[model samples]
Target: MDPTHADLERFCAELKAMWEACGPPVLTSVEKYGGPKKSQVSTILNGDITTVPDIDNVAAILKACLANARAKGLEPPANAEFDYWKGRLGSLTRARSNHSEPGPAGNPWRDLAGTHPVWESTTDREFFRPRVVKAAAHLFDRRRRAATVLAGDDWLDETLAQRMTDRMGDLLTGRLASPAIRFGGVEASLIVLAPLLHQVRVAESAAALIGVRPIELRPSASAGPLRSDYERFLAGSEQSRLVARTELTGVPGRTGAKNEIGWWLFHQWVMRRQDPVPTATAPHDLPIAEEPLRTVLAGTLDRLVKLFHLSPDGLRNKERRNLVHKVSHPSITPALQDVRELLVGLLLVTAHKLAVELTALPSTIVEHLGIPNPVDLGRLRALLTGMTWQPLEVIGIGLYAQCHHEAVLEALLAHVRQTDAVLGSVRDVATDRVHLEPLLRLPPRASADFVTPAPHPDNHTRPAFVVPVTRFRIDETRVRELLMGEQLYSDRSLAIRELYQNALDACRYKQARHRYRAALEDT
Candidate 1:
């Protein structure tokens, strides 16, 4: 075995031992600077070595492990222990020259590759998380829009729309618990999206979903010559919006008329008997209202269909496309690179849709609430939404890294965060919205980090309140009798005498203290 690879493996093994002894902390809890992402840290703990580990990342993991140990009441590792690990890392770093660069290999769908460089904290979120979220959001939005328009005059299917909204929230926030949505892989995207795609029924509301009417695209001699096909297609009143959407999709074939867009939308990329399959299942019988519009739409539809790699007869070939259906159904022996390509393409399309569409609008709760500060309202919405999606997005980032590296599945379980814990945070924020409103508006720490409420203090039994003994007693009856002045003089006289004695005692006590202080000064 290569010396560097061997040393790297040994380092990983020892690191794992340390983790088990300290704790495989919830990876996110490890506080370190300039460290590898939690997912990479997780891989290290699992002894899945591909590249030379960063020393700072290694030190951070060790530090976190030690911190966890200290929290658990274990004795702190001595300086010598730290020095030993540091020495190991130093040796591994020096031997790094002998190690060959890593590349992709493994199960096409799940295994994380070794070649994918470790993600930094910020870059992880920037690359792939937003794309998955935005895709799901846009796709969910399009479905809702289609439902309202196509359900016709009698359409009152609020239930379907609500379910879709909830499902979208659940998926985005990582509350939904299914393997299909867990990994943020192409399979996961396809699985989460497949049902909604079927529900859209593109033929019935093609015009509405496409967002532009067929008649609106009528050829005009008044329109000036264009330098590019894109300019020609977008020439008109809605040209600005169309140009923006095109950039958003990143798919050149996306800009087209209702029928043309609808054709692509209708085809569902699905898992059939555990194999990837693309079927023209959604009906495409939308009628062309005008003959001239119909002729124009047909040609446009043909061109887009051809551009997207579908046969004229609606048959799909085993070629790379927007959806990952290249593998023959039930066959698992395909090249890893091909699988990676399919996933990348699918994700890119979804992410592009997310970027173009209005994905970051406030949730309905945020919109309806009577929050005064725009900043507070916006931040609260982000907190609620980010809590839901961040966990899943992290996993998506890992998958994106893996595919990008062209590597196979490593330890995917390592990437999973406490999603339930995350959703619980969302619930906490929503339930405490009334209480949180004031905090949300406060300045100079307005968006201070929120802590989840601890269990009620009342849950455990404690000592009861202690009542103090009476320092004095009120003689209400005597006072009333005295006030009347009709009582015998002897009884009134006794009460008055007692009050006088108490007053004299207090004055004398003060006089004595004063005299004593004077006497001490004289001495």
Candidate 2:
């Protein structure tokens, strides 16, 4: 697939090796087994092709080779062999067209995708998944309620709070909803809560975000399975995007606003940022509907709050305070149970929101963002219709919990307990006033006890035997022999040939890096 045909030749050579390993079946026999025509098979097996072969032909040849391998009583490749080769085929296909425009064929957006800013809308059902919309609604609900709570609790200016909270209530719970909420309130609420909300750290938040090792959650534990799950999700997201990319980009006239709207939905809904919609590097500003955007976000928050079992609005000030209360405070340590639940819920909403946003974008853009395609939009509607989003019970727990929530929750609970114990122990005996000085001033005492052995009157000698665990160690001389000796190569000239091949491969790899800036940046 490479422009120089090096990769294509390498692929053919590998196929030839596979064919030879399978007793070097005749071209006719391979063709009989549903492979390409005899002449084409011969050319392919000869490893002299200049162009990338058709995928169907490659698949057929692989099948025939696999069949021959099986007939010779040899061990067949793993079940994923087909998939592995299929991926290689896809890579080759992309490499073949590396110089082509990005995005779907015949689309002008393909040319403009990277040069111009993208547009997105959170309210667009076509763009956002239902659950994401639902999640956004919930977030909106919380922000408004939080604003109202701050107002009633005298945290904000009374008049401003009143304007924000007015008519934003549900009749049943005496709370507010999206339709009644004002744009001023939405913006104000976001600014006001940004500080507190930003400070609220869930132990697994970083792990969830980066698929990195659990940093805040675990003090000493390894990242464990978290990284792999996140990696898998990312891989799957990319795969899904690739599968659906052509269709998405093929949507006619997809130059400016739609792309921006999709990205905005992703950033605001999935990433949960309140920044204004992005502008193009071009001089002109894109016309974005501000009031509608604010309305959609407000709605999603309200829905999410209800999902969290909180009132939409009204005098839920105490409950709101507890929701955002700092987790480290000893007085409110037990309140972390609810906090964990809320955090988990937020994660769920974000996950669904992310899934929706990615599914709506073109493959190139999705690849650029490295976002997850968690659900197939086509099937998601039918699948999620009967389902209710529950954070504590079920939903995203299988993958999200292992990678993010589960360990962090346990660690958080343990941390709370430990803090409570330390604080409890430092209480003054006479004055009964809690003293904080000892905690900072004194060194930590050992949690476990140690004792010295009593003297042995007989003075008898005792020996301890420990079992040895052996590991393979490479000898320096042997490594040198392996590298330079005739053990590996009968002809010394073969070594020079391999080195030259490796040099060429390195050049090809560098060229590939130059072709895909996004992938290069990620690495």
Candidate 3:
């Protein structure tokens, strides 16, 4: 007896259930009873094949299961089970035979329309509404299925699940367009229409969000189609003038000369122009009252006194004398006292120079003078007191701004010359010592105490010294000619195309080789 589709489906279901319940023995073990391989077994159980399995194969599977059960020390099913399956198979065969009877010929019109008789009788609205509703329901079901597959074994909390649902709703309602919906539109339509609708919804939502109002298709006149003659004249005049200027100034017999001409015109008309008033030198003198000057001087003196106790005895001390000498004669020795004194003397000199140059001493210089670390207040005061006469004279000259103060100028010049002479001597000594230090160091001994030993001569036969054989000298010019010569192809373009083709072929060959190698490894 043959089995019907329902009988095959039921039997497959029952067989799958039994296989699942028994710990699902491997296909290899089941094959001993003439059962198919695992893939064939899966196809049969899944009812994926058009035809049903033979009764003999079905019986073989039952026997295999019984064998497996007994081997596992489990009780085998009674003969009743076999009887039941046999009866079911027989019934299915009878039903299939009865159902196989030829039916009325199918109507070609109905077949062409792909509709049933009931559908043909109903109105369009009645037929479509249920389909639309069913399609919508199916779309939602598909989304749920997709979400489930994506979720896998992950425990999605309520909040996350709610968010996902909301996002899906947004996608469906055209509020959010996702890439999946856009690119997978056609594919998703076959499954369900939600994805395509999602993309449309998203686009609509975006357009709405952006407040893109629909514009009239017809062209509208701007500003009542009026033209400003003055503006037109100005624009035309400027364009003509630009063209004339380019033609007039452009270099003769040169390509791209207009750009150069424009640049030249710009430089002459704008960049080369000068301002009437000079900006470099501005008068900085502020006409303040004599009282402000006195006040500033008095404050400066008081701070200096407090900063460095400026007593007459402290000025004439041995430490102050040594400080003056250190400033006059800079040394290479890292003596902390000498460095501190020298820095203090230089600070005082710089302050005097600033007082002469600037109308008011800058606060920054004053701050530096206030620091009393290695050089204490007393030492700074002593150094300042020693130079007090020179600064006063220099200040007077600077303030009077008269050319007849040559005496004072000469004295200052003489002092600078002396300082320069001392610096020159120090520089010469440093240069000579730095340049000669390595050369002056004691040389290494050449005798037994330091000399390197030489290798002893061997008494064995010496290997013959062989000169290298030169086969060829590369002709670089010829090589370049071979690569670049027009003779290689009918034209330069063809040559380039040929080179490109060779490169492409090489790349393809390499890719194929790599792919083959990878396939071999996989196998």
Candidate 4:
């Protein structure tokens, strides 16, 4: 189907050569058979003018193919002439054998099937009388003709022996088996079952072995072949399923609370000074959040801003925008809440990858940050434009949503405890970073927004808590050196995670560092 008409023309040309190589027979009486003379045989050959192919030549080709095919257990030609022709070529000839077997008396199959008149019945017609008859006849005709041309006067005796030997060989090779056949619907019959014609019969034994009762296997609808992957896809192995579940839920003791570590890391980073330790309230009149929370929140905000490539709130108009601005007007708040979620997840995942890399078996750092679900990545996306949020891949929408919810839970919990202002366990969230916004979305509570000291520009992206993995005295040069080597630090996740882990160690082991609960204790 993919081929064009040109391909068909080329195939027809090849057919012409094959016909010439084969000595095909035509009905002949040396005079009665009428058609073009030898001089006008162009109809049977390729030339400028196209003509119908010679019927006899096509028949011979088909017969030869069928004979070969029948020997190989493939389908064969349908016409009776071809089947007899196959038997003739396959078996040796003898005077005692059928005359038409291989001598151009046409084919036996056609005569037996009444395809030819009774008087015109060929030696080929009588040859198929016995399954072995054609084999003997074909051998005689060929060997006798060959011996006359090769061994001279001794042709008769010598040819008989040679022809018999050749026929026996056909027996062993199965070329002496069933006659040629062709495409037809349920068309086999015992009368048609005879030696194939025109094909070379190699070993005589093959003829003896064929045409035996065939085996037919009962078809089973369900017993078909299957793909190799079938079993794996269907079978729910305990180990693989377990892995899938762990990855989906992010195992509680695994990836959840790494965010809490951020809260801790932030505090330590803002102030590397360990002695006469800097306090959150130590900065004179500044009423920052409790010691560690203030510094941690501030540092975390700085990191978030950096992670998103957001311009600091104060820095502006550095990059070109869609419209010209007078340094006077600013677009709406760049969304920061949505951006925070992605950064937080990256931090958590980074921590997990680190733990596996370092072979560090830290328990439950992420689990502590198990935020609620319905991870509203979609809702959060809208919020970003409303708040002038920073850059964050949308993929982390679900993650940020969960983190945002976690923060809300922490905030609600903190509010109730600090002011003895008990509210029902939060049912639904209206906005991120819980404000005095009433539970009802309708009339914004007059006190809903941060009415007290407003959040600082630097504090916009900062979440309530984050933890760093570790902290130690190191020159800025040393920190950079480790980064360059990817040894002591990696990215935010590694640096922040290590800092947090260190702070936790410092908090628990007083002997490890100066005791500083101000940085960690929930303010």
Candidate with maximal lDDT: 1
TM match of model 4 to true structure: 0.13
Candidate 4 local distance difference test against the native: 0.27
Instruction: Count steric clashes of candidate 4.
Output: 88
Q: How much is 223 displaced in model 2, in angstroms? A: 36
lDDT for 441 in candidate 4 is: 22
| Candidate 2, 206-242: lDDT as tens digits | 2123334211211224445544443343344333333
Compare candidates 3 and 4 on TM-score and give the better one: 3
Task: List the global CA lDDT of all models.
Answer: 0.35, 0.34, 0.32, 0.27
Residue 125 displacement in candidate 3 (angstroms) = 56
Residue 69 of model 1: what lDDT?
Answer: 80
**How high is each candidate's TM-score?**
0.19, 0.27, 0.19, 0.13
For candidate 1, lDDT tens digit of each residue in 208-296?
32233232333444434321322344453333333233233344434323322222112111110122222332212223233432333
Q: Find the candidate with the highest TM-score and give its number.
A: 2
How many Å off is the CA of 432 in candidate 4?
35
TM-score, prediction 3: 0.19
Better of 1 and 2 by TM-score: 2
Model 3 global lDDT (CA atoms, 0 to 1): 0.32
